[model samples]
Target: MTDKSEYKDSFRCGYVAVLGRPNVGKSTLMNHILGQKVSITSRKPQTTRHRVLGIYTDDDAQILFVDTPGIHRKEARSINRYMNRAASSSMADVDVLLFVVDGTQWTDDDELVLEKLSHAKGKKVLFVNKVDKLADKEEVLPHIAHITEQCDFDAVFPGSALRGHNLDELTKTLKQWLPEGDLFYPEDYITDRSERFMAAELIREKLMRSLGEEIPYSSTVEIEQFKFNDKGILTISGLILVERSGQKAIIIGKGGQRLKQIGRDARIEMEELFDSKVFLELWVKVKDGWADDERALKSLGYDDYR
Candidate 1:
């Protein structure tokens, strides 16, 4: 941990909330900026269901990047409401609000995020992500122009989060907006989340990637056991909770092949992230209406922001 007094007088440190609708690459942008995988991401919408902090420290500034859940109009379930609350809450008490949008297209969800951001106070930055997907380079300017027309932004940059394009310039510009202050987190700390929470997220990411559209959203991961054994290997046991038995059956697959593959994939990533020998065990359990039940959602670690 780096002490606040140890930093120079000119050092700048503050929170930057990364706000956007689901599947807009908010997590991907934060991960690339920190040069590490602190936030889990997938093609599925609302992959990030919590307000994850990714701390970045450099010689000049320390940026506490708050990677939040994508704000959408759908508040269909308890989990959805929880995610929206988590994201909306992050808007307060941040030094900057980095609004990310898919440059290829825009939707009502983007407008919803912008409307929510309108009430928040901060240095607002518009990030037009996925510009690389655009067939013509000229299309970028018009798209950026259209978005900026709706709301006044302090700064706007068009870049590709996946390819790490224009992010360096964006970071430099963001540093200018932050006031000089002490580091919020230690210099070496990359995230505020615990290793146990990260393990559960990794398992959930595998579930999202492996399963079909509906199951991933209905499922959640709970870390039952996490500890270093006497053999110097980290052993983890995770329970996958779903709303229905049919969803559990689909995840378990024929002879449990699907579950085994998901666990294997998660374990491999855990080994790389934890930098240790990992022994991961996974089990599927049906918890009826867990996603909609407020008590169940809270027990599953969904109410931290609330």
Candidate 2:
């Protein structure tokens, strides 16, 4: 797959940044494009905190998809500021920008995305996602029409990432705009993120789903230990950080039932993701105001990976 002969003389390759407000299916779109889950998704906003690259290669084209944290106007905490910076930085030095939005609803945040796009000088493409949830199918065209008035985008695509709708058409359009260049990664590689990073994300995904509203925004997961034992079974020790003892009690639940369930579910996902047996352990620790501290964020592995 690494052989240059596998590629054609006119092979196209370029970076495409997937930018939008939070919870607008940006991660879902990238997962569908790559045919695997490189970014975590949940009902909760701000699920993606760092930038991840999903690479797709074929006979004539290779698309390096940049899945960034969602952009918003509010930068209340250091983490929010970091997310905004990550999203904005992804827009620079890209062949094109795929600005995604929820077709079912519109808000000032959508306008905020447009404002960001207004300053970006590269080719812009719009994707109105989640059209399958609309009560009336006819609302899609009107929504696209309204957004077209705001910015003269090079192209507009309306599709549903959830249902795999119109994605083939979307891929065709993206391939046409790429520049002729060598592949940045080998054809067999789907993502640039390490296995440890993905393990932490998978654990966080389970916690977010299990704890639901009781979990505070300050909560984060860090893998303290990850190694294979003599028998070749993976062993993992994770630290679940919270802001207060009360949050810890809530996560622990009565007789530690809740934490056990969270660990059980997370271990199952880890085994599936790694394709090996895993022995997992979890502990809750209080880290007061870690989200607001920039140094703490860096220690928690929130910094950019390149």
Candidate 3:
């Protein structure tokens, strides 16, 4: 163990909430920064439903990156409301707020996120993600300029989360903004979430990736069983909840092949993450209108933001 007394005076540590609209690469940025996948990601919007912590620690600083759900205009369902709340509440009590936007293209949802960012108390930083996708490189400067005019930011950076562009500079800038303090987590700890929570998220990521657009949004995962056997084979049983029987059928697919593939993909990732052999079981259950049901949402672990 390293002695805390050596670096106590100069060590920097704080929470940095990564805020953005859906599909802007906020989760991807944090995952890349931490050099691991603490938060799950997919092309689908609203792929991240919870506020996941990605801890990055070096010799000088420990950056607690809070990967939040994207703030969007949609609040029709209880889940949507929960996601918005999760994103908004994360801004509170954080040392820095990293507001990410897509390259050169801003939407109504981005405006909504900016509006939310305006009221936040933390030192705000703007990140223009996916800049590599831009056709004309000159467009980056003017686009960032336009956004900075709308609201004040401590710093701005244009980078591609997928391509690992300018991320080292971003990390260095974030460290400067954090307050000097003792470490919030152990040096080896990469995230604040438990293995069980990560298991549920890993399963959910596979669900989102495997199914079509509609089914992914209408579903959530619950870990029914998680344990280790005598020979150290970890066993996990996941119950996937969907809104209707028809959707459930689609996920399970013809001859249970789709569900089997989802289980296989999830188990492989789980094994790599847990560093042990895994026995995975999956079942789909129809939980009608759970997404819109407030009580059901609360029971399904969506009430953490409150």
Tell me, what's the RMSD of every candidate? 1.1, 1.5, 1.2
- On TM-score, who's better, 2 or 3? 3
lDDT of each: 0.92, 0.88, 0.92
| Model 1 quality (TM-score) | 0.97
How many clashes in each candidate?
Answer: 0, 0, 0
Candidate 2 on 44-154: residue-level lDDT in tens? 888888999999888989999999998988888998988888998999999999999998588888899899898887889999998888889898888888888988899
State the lDDT of candidate 3 residue by residue for 24-43, as single tens digits: 99999999999999999999
Q: Write the per-residue lDDT of candidate 1 for residues 1-306, one digit (tens) a residue.
A: 577666677999888999999999999999999999999989999899999999999988999999999999979998999999999999999999999999858889999998987778989999999988988989888888887887889999989999999999999999988899888777999999999999999999999999899999989999999999898899999999998989999999999999999999999999999999999999999999999999988888888885
lDDT of 2 at 74: 87
Which pairs, if any, clash in model 1? Answer: none
Ranking by lDDT: 1, 3, 2
Output the worst ten-in-a-row residue range by lDDT, candidate 2.
209-218
Clashing pairs in model 2?
A: none
How do all the candidates rank in terms of TM-score, highest first? 3, 1, 2
Model 2 vs. true fold: TM = 0.96
Residue 127 lDDT, candidate 2, scale 0-100: 92
